[model samples]
Target: MAGSLVDVALPLPVYSTFTYSVEGPVPPAGTRVLVPFRREERIGWIVGAGSGAGLTRVRPILDILEGEPSVPPELLELSGWIADYYLAPLGMVLRTSLPSALSDSSRDYLTLVGKADDVGTPRERKLLAALGQGGAPRRVRTLRKALAMGSIWPEIRALATQGRICHQTVPPRDPPVRTHRVVRVMNWLSDLNDRENMFRRASRQREAYEALESSGGSAELAHLLHQGGFSRSVIRGLEDKGVVVLEDVEVLRDPFREEIRAEPKKLVPTRDQAAVLAALGEMLQEPNPPPALLHGVTGSGKTLVYIELLKEVVHNRNQGAIVLVPEIALTPQTVSRFRAHFGDDVAVLHSALSEGERFDAWRQLREGKKRIAVGARSAVFAPIPRLGAIVVDEEHDGSYKQSEGPRYQARDVAIVRAARVGALCLLGSATPSLESWQNAQIGKFRLFSLLNRVGGGALPPV
Candidate 1:
């Protein structure tokens, strides 16, 4: 609620968000804006509002890119928590939440575009020859490291314009193939009932056939190939035999979000579950809850306990809760639990998603349409803005520790995250991590042990 000049935190590893001035109007917090740091461009988050006083040497913001705030205030706070606790730069923490496209990053590349021959001088011509041989594009940095030269963006742009062989910034990716394969006998299947090998071949094809058949018609080629075990030659053989058919498959643009409709069954909480729920609820209502530990054996009603608490938390505020599970939580069986309790309000985020799918989940988090995000390590950043509480199921699982890049432990990060915005942090696990157990025993954290299994089930011996 200040002015047009503000400090933003980028998600880049560069340590911090460079300050930028807004010409038109200052963006509200959580808005995604582009800022320039030297020659590189960056997408960053506005964590704080500005006062527009003594803001000098600040370049104008490139753009206020997001129509709605792509992140929530609570998430921004969580990013700060990750940066501090993980010993990461604030910008780098934010970067983990962004999609590649939003970052608009292009690696410097060296290209050849002259007469394919006028590459200039022996060294330049040799590099040009390598470019003309053209199996794949090389980054200019890679080219420079090999060539041991200086900044080359200008020369590369010139080469692109001259068509001597063009140089352009490109994302690193494996070359894609334009070839196609026949997966099934779409049109011929119903007609060719009596052909030779028809029964046996079609018998094997039955799985693929049924898969395509089950798609309610028009399944993607990849789905068919993977599901049916039909290779290019097999599909071609089928095509030649006039069995099933194959068609050009367009890429699925929208990331797939399973529309899970779960009916909340009449849940009968065990005494232990009831006690833990009561203890956690009381803790959440306080000024700051000592991290609540739910130590239940596997098969104990940890999830049921979460559902009851979430139901209470969401109904009381405009914000919602985040259910942090290991990446394995995305499995069909586990998702069904949250789906049953929260239904469509659950947003799933994980690395298994395509870039577009991640964007979609981020979009959902932005719009406040999704109140519950069940995801792996990265879901800790799920854009739930008002984040009232976080339930880290299996809180001790090592899967919560990210090994590469910003290697922040999800459980630890979630604690700092909850602490930032005064949210209740509950870690529920049958087998508590030694760190959590030690922390609890020493009174660093308040712990709740649920020894009884829900629904009269026996607690697994652990």
Candidate 2:
């Protein structure tokens, strides 16, 4: 019997979606799948159902990358809108919305099959040595780095043809969630007399147990060991005696974990700021709030207004928010301020972060662990469930416009996303862009002005 047909979008420059057949129940749109494209297999996203009425041949999907949809349904719709508006391929737009790690294709790994000492050339010997006998298969890229040379593909192909090495294609693995082992005292150790008797011989074990007890009976394995200057054997001794149990626990890779968090300050808003917040609060209640332009001069306390408004949105309304800064240079200060106000409720995203860091941050926002995302232009695509507000600071800056394919204006995208999700979009700028100013003038956007700086300070003479 024929399999179900679905439309798949590859990460190529092509403008069209391809049809592929699947064996089991059809994977829903937004699910990632591996499909045969010409001679090579490519990772593609299922956009929708496909019709096999006219086509004589439809390739079967090689594999389904994810059990659940990696791209949310709403994001699929948003990507479609972006593609249409920006005249970009739907696949490219979808790619832009997700972390690059998610789109990595299968890789080729080489392993030694024949005698390594009998190689024809020194380079081949080096390659074989890199893949030691019975060692794990290594990728060409890894071998290249180990050998400190460029383009080993020719040598790899020659070795393979000579039956000196074996090749295999391995699918990309998901990023491992960070985790650490934790130690906890067993309830049976609660008896002081029994605990004393158990630890009478082992002084170091006793000290470690006492430290764990002081730490509420549970602590990270590394921290517990470090605090007591104890070795793993000491903990193992306690574990063997049934005094404590060790287990692994998942931990988030927080980018701001090292920075000392600032104390949150409660500042009274100026009269103008209060009025603007009041107006935005009312707008938030609407089904589809019109985007608002906040024309506040420098030193007008625009950031404080954002913090207050986000407090209401996140704490009161039980929704999420995304704050977009124009440059990576600005992200540190913006994130610091937001983190001070929101604590771990905030997540940071940008190009400066490593691939693993970016993946973790995206996951945090998607899983609702972090309710606010503060970053640069790319952050406008943050997967914040139940989004209630989007704040674009310095909305007029050219940094918000992406220069490559799928050249999107993040400020504009934030407005569209907010509208789609029935959230309030706030664009704040000391000098508003002409398009936004005109939009406000023609009633396309609601206008709010901050006439004076906070603390009775006057604007510098222009």
Candidate 3:
């Protein structure tokens, strides 16, 4: 029987997806696969199953790169819509939906096989020398940098053919998961007198044990060593006596590390804010509710309405949410507020973060460890499972339109994505965009107006 075939989308400028045969059971859509594209192997996304009957030749997939689909089904459909609506390539759209670290392709690593003196050419000898007598395999890029010349592929290939060197394609490595050692009290002494008698000989161990006990039985190893002035030997001594245990615990990197400590403030909505939320709450109850345009003056408590609505969507309905800010500058403030309310349930995503930080945040949301995501334009694509609401703050700002590749308007994408998932889309702005204004005027969007500012503040002069 013929092997099952699947359609793959390569991250190139091509508009059509290519067909490849799956040697085993066909993987689901959104699975990343390494496949031979012409001469070079490239990473591609599995969009869906394909038919081998129409094609005369279909290359078998080299490997399924991931155990699970990197892109979820709802996101795959959302990416397709964005591609079709923006006239962008589907591959490019899919690539945009994921982190750049994930899209990296495999690279070639070279290892020395034969003695360096046996090489024929200076370049080949230099390459083998760099490989260092069968030591750890060196990346081809590293060898080229050491040679300080362009296009060493010819020399490297020749050396491999001569049996003097061997090359292997290594898949891209993901950013390491952050973790730290923590010490916890495993078994405690029976009583106060018993604890004193057990630790009578070791005062430092007794202090460390007391510290751990005061810290609710566990503390980060670093904190215990530095702040608590405890020595490693003391911890080891406790572990040896079966009084405590050491463990490596995964730690989520917080991009807004300092701002997360802000105290959460509870605010009662103003009469106007309450009314607007009431109307929006009603609309949210409907299936695939129409987008709502919140026309409120600056400082008119529009954000308060959003907070209340999200509380209902997230806490009451038990679904995830995405909050899109217009600028990265806004992310810290926005994330601080959301984190204050949602605590660790919120994850921040934006371009300003390091690759590892972004990956960690994405993983948190994808795994449902985080229920709320707050970021700039790209955060709209945050893998929020069971999305129930999306709030596009300052939706009228031109920053909502991406200026580079894909060039999608994030505000519009948020609306479409929410609609596709049967969720509510809330667009808030003091001065609305022309398209949104027109949509509201034509009743295409349910319009809610906030006339009075909280604390009776006057509206800004137009």
Candidate 4:
């Protein structure tokens, strides 16, 4: 049996994970634990389980808040690695990984949902009445100056504690908590017989037990079972052991896809296209294959090739693909080409979508509402499971690099994401980036060269 305590890292201005007790109820690592932070109860993102320090003084968590942890441990682990590698704070890394809403949970007075009445308390009523008598929801800052409440947070908290009026954080717009029904395997850590059973279990069961063992305690079900695909019962049993845990961190989805389906299309490939596609296809089938650079000159039907391969991958129904283009290329004409063939099966993520629209689009991909996602840089994070391939049009385009915030280069990041997800890559460009050209010459990627247009249109004044 695993220990009953854990350390959870809340993504905040701080950098460390807070240690808390989970003896009575075994919540998963990604659970959002409402701990007694400082003097107030605050929500902290959970990292993993640990033995709560009994040797030293510590406060128990206020309550394991309802809902699943939104962030996955693997993502948390990866984000932590990125923060460390880039010399960034873990909390800042969490901030970037999380949505814009989680950091700010405060609320304001507004027209209550479905009702117009001021549903606030006396203090809140005072503010709301003032807003009602004068005009509308006043900025708390301005309200503080006008109402002389000193600091509104306390009053807001008190008023909020009553549920009389709505605060800025009435209900989290992008709630970080996702409801996850998890079952964990339980073991008698105190029983010597349990250790013997673990060693002699069936191969599949033993493999799972061993993997969890390697995890040092808590492991995400999806990740730990990726190899042999363990049963939910097994997970439950582990939880019984107080080892396998489940919680909801922020659940981030591929901001582009809403469903998973093969929006395959037939490709009218030229002879060059046919040959190159076959060759690259073969290359992708190899073990540990590198990215492929398809030097399809401008108007060389690279899009057609994309359709062909995507059709093939979807036809298999076991994997999916992502098509990345320059953000500017998502203009109507460019976007239309893929949509004309794929129809509603394609989801595009770009700057055009409102925050709500963007979140919904991302949710669609995350929920598997859309399968194939195409967009600018951020689209690289599409949530499609079992990604089979990725096609980067105009791989050399400078717009692929993101300059702010995460400061990650899309083309490079796509390569990393593809490798992590076992997806094949096709980098097509008329004027290839010098780096790509160099990679091609060195045999780092299979290079397919396209020379002429399919058929002559004007005959060049011959």
C-alpha lDDT score of every prediction, in listed order:
0.70, 0.88, 0.86, 0.64
TM-score result, candidate 1? 0.68
What's the candidate order when arranged by decreasing lDDT? Answer: 2, 3, 1, 4
Could you tell me which 10 consecutive residues in candidate 2 have the lowest summed lDDT? 326-335
Give stretches of model 2 more than 4 Å off: 111-164, 185-187, 190-207, 239-243, 328-331
- Worst ten-residue run, lDDT, model 1? 171-180
Per candidate, the number of residue pairs that clash is: 18, 0, 0, 52
Off by over 4 Å in 3: 54-56, 111-155, 184-218, 227-246, 257-260, 264-266, 328-331, 459-462
Candidate 2 on 1-462: residue-level lDDT in tens? 279999998888988899999998998899999887764567889999998778998889999988888889889999999888998999998889998888877777888885677547888888888888458788766778878967787788898898888988777666657789999888557778887888788989988888888888889998866766789999999889888999888887777899999987779998899999999999988999999999999999999889999999999999999999877456566678888989999988877888878989999899999999988888988989899999999999999999999889999999999999999999999999999999999999999999788888987787
RMSD of each: 9.5, 4.2, 4.0, 15.5
Best by lDDT: 2
Candidate 2 clashes between residue pairs 3 or more apart in a chain or in different chains: none
Assess candidate 4 and give its TM-score to the true structure.
Answer: 0.61
Per TM-score, the best of the predicted structures is 2
For 1-462, candidate 1 gives per-residue lDDT tens digits of 223667788766666556667776667787877667665565677777555555556677776776666566666777777777778887677777665556655465554544467545555565666666664677666776766656554555555666665555443232122344434445535544454346574555555555656765455566556755666565565556665667664232333344546676897888777887888778878877778888886677788888889988887665678888888666967777777877767777777776766666666665777888788878777767677898898887889888876878888878887887788888998889898999999998898887665555774455
Question: Which scores greater on TM-score, model 2 or model 4?
Answer: 2
Q: Which scores better on lDDT, 2 or 4? A: 2
Model 3 lDDT at residue 104: 83
lDDT of 3 by residue, 1-462 (tens): 368888999989888899998887888899988899864678889998886666778888898888999899999999999888988888888889888877888888887774567447787676677788548888877777877977788887787788887889877666457899999889877598989888889999999998888999999999999999888898999999999999999988886666537887879988888888899889878997999999998789887787888889889999999988878447456667777777888888777788878888899899999999888899999999999999999998889898987879999999999989999999999899999999999999999998777899886575
